[model samples]
Target chain A: MDSVTALGLVAAVLTTGSFLPQAIKTWKTKSTKDVSIVMYLLLCTGIILWTAYGFLIGSIPVIAANVVSFIFTFAILALKIKYK
Target chain B: MDSVTALGLVAAVLTTGSFLPQAIKTWKTKSTKDVSIVMYLLLCTGIILWTAYGFLIGSIPVIAANVVSFIFTFAILALKIKYK
Candidate 1:
């Protein structure tokens, strides 16, 4: 890919991957107390919108990142509800 | 703005604004226990890169969103350090 795409991909990876550890921790610890319910709710909604926007724009980087992020956010959201 | 730009702006607003409540809560509660240190660190770095990428690409929506996000992440990161 070109440099711009590479930059976007790298940015996407770092931002998206940042959530992985938290999701795993939440899963293992069954703790969503510290994780803000409002934040997750908003984030999940935002991720869905971002994914749709990415699709509309035909941006692979945005689509790929948001897809993974959507899953992670959904996972966190589910845990938030379950643990609440 | 055009439709594509409007879509991107909306997407950016949602995703970036999602963090505002968390940042405000953290500022008020002074709690970073549930907030993942690793996530914020990586996210802050990613936001910086995204801002730079946005600048390079001349994307006003991306730049605007990432700038706001960067500020919130920085606040969270600072709290994470102080409260750790």
Candidate 2:
């Protein structure tokens, strides 16, 4: 793959992967007190929009990153609402 | 601006703005105990690359989002290193 695509992939992996630990923590701890619900809500909204935008533009990188991010972030957001 | 640009702007605003609270928390508390340092390091690296990728593609949305994200994430990272 090209460097651009590689960088996009890297961005997706690291950024998306960054959430894994937190998600696991929330799951294991079952505590969402410290997490900002507003932030997650807005973030999930933006991720969904970006996903649609990516689809409109037919950009795989954008689509791929936001898909994982969408799921992960949504789970976090849902938990925040449920727990907090 | 076009809808594409507007959506991109919205993406940048919501997504990047989401970091403000976290950065402030780390700044005020001077604590990085809850944060994942390795993730931040990798994320910052990816953000920087995405910035470059945006510049290469002449995509303002990518560039703007990443610039703000880079600064925010990096500041958090620096604090993480200093504190943790």
Candidate 3:
């Protein structure tokens, strides 16, 4: 793969990795009072916009990553709202 | 902004938003048993790669989004791992 593509993919990995700890912690604790609702809300907004940009450009990589990301985020969001 | 830039921004927004529900849900419930640790791990890999690509290319949009995304995803992942 080209360097640009590879880098883009790497960025995705890092961002997602950073959040895993929180996800795991929440699962075991059944409590996310410390987590920030605004952060999620803002982050989701940014992600969605990027996903749409990918579609507009007909970019497969963007589409694929965003699709999975949306699902992952959605699951956590639901739990947060429901449990809160 | 140019169309490509605008479009890219939009894509970011959509993908992120899709996951907000899940994030929010997990935050409130403090339970992410249903969420997949594997998925987060893989996603983090992709996001980090993408973010790197943007840096290499000097693309502000990619860098900004991935940076935020990584933090967001990392938070959830941490919670999941810790609590589960």
Candidate 4:
């Protein structure tokens, strides 16, 4: 892969993978009180749109990163609602 | 701008703007107990890399988005540190 694409992939992995720990923490603790609902709601919506944008641009890295990101954000969103 | 670029800008705005409320909430509440330090640290690092990647790729939207994103993430990181 070209350097720019590789950089994008690395950026994607770092940004997207960062959420995993938060999701897991929230899951294990069942405490999303400090996690703002408004923020997650907006984030979840934005991530869906990001995935669409990624698809439009035909960037597999963006698409793949956002899809995984959407899952994690959705999980946090769901957990927030459940534990609320 | 072309449709793809416009879409990208919209996606960037949505995602980046989503963080504002969280930052505000944290600032007002002064409670970041549930905010995972690992997640924010990784996110902040990723955002810095994203800004660099955007510069490398010559995407103004990406660069602008990531700069704002980095500020917000850094704010959260600072708050988490102070309140921890």
Which candidate gets the maximum lDDT versus the true structure? Answer: 4
Q: How good is model 2 by TM-score?
A: 0.84
Q: Is candidate 1 or candidate 3 better by lDDT?
A: 1
Judge candidate 3 at residue A38 and give its lDDT. Answer: 59
Q: Candidate 3 residues B6-76, lDDT tens each?
A: 66666666545445555666777888665667756766676677776777899886678667766766767
Off by over 4 Å in 2: none
lDDT of candidates 1 onward, in order: 0.84, 0.78, 0.64, 0.88
User: For model 2, how big is the iRMS in angstroms?
Assistant: 2.2
Clashing pairs in 1: none
lDDT of 4 by residue, A1-84 (tens): 888877777788889998898899999999888898898888888888888888988887788888999999899999999998
Shift of residue A10 alpha carbon in model 2, Å: 2.1
Better of 2 and 3 by DockQ: 2
Ranking by lDDT: 4, 1, 2, 3
Candidate 1 chain A lowest-lDDT run of ten: A31-40
Mind giving the per-residue lDDT tens digits that candidate 2 earns over B1-84?
Answer: 779767867876888888777788778888665465665777788788888888888988778888999888898889888887
As a TM-score, model 1 comes out at 0.93
Worst 10-residue stretch by lDDT in candidate 2 chain B? B31-40
Q: TM-score, each model?
A: 0.93, 0.84, 0.58, 0.95
How many angstroms is residue A16 displaced in model 3 relative to the true structure, after the best TM-score fit? 3.3
What tens digits encode model 1's per-residue C-alpha lDDT throughout A11-69? 98999998887888788888776677888888888888888888988888789899999
lDDT of 3 at B47: 65
lDDT tens readout by residue for model 3, A1-84: 986666666665555454565566566666755455555565566667767777888988767766666665655665667666
The stretch of ten residues in a row with the least summed lDDT in candidate 3 chain B is: B13-22
Question: What is the RMSD, in Å, between candidate 4 and the native fold over all Cα?
Answer: 1.1
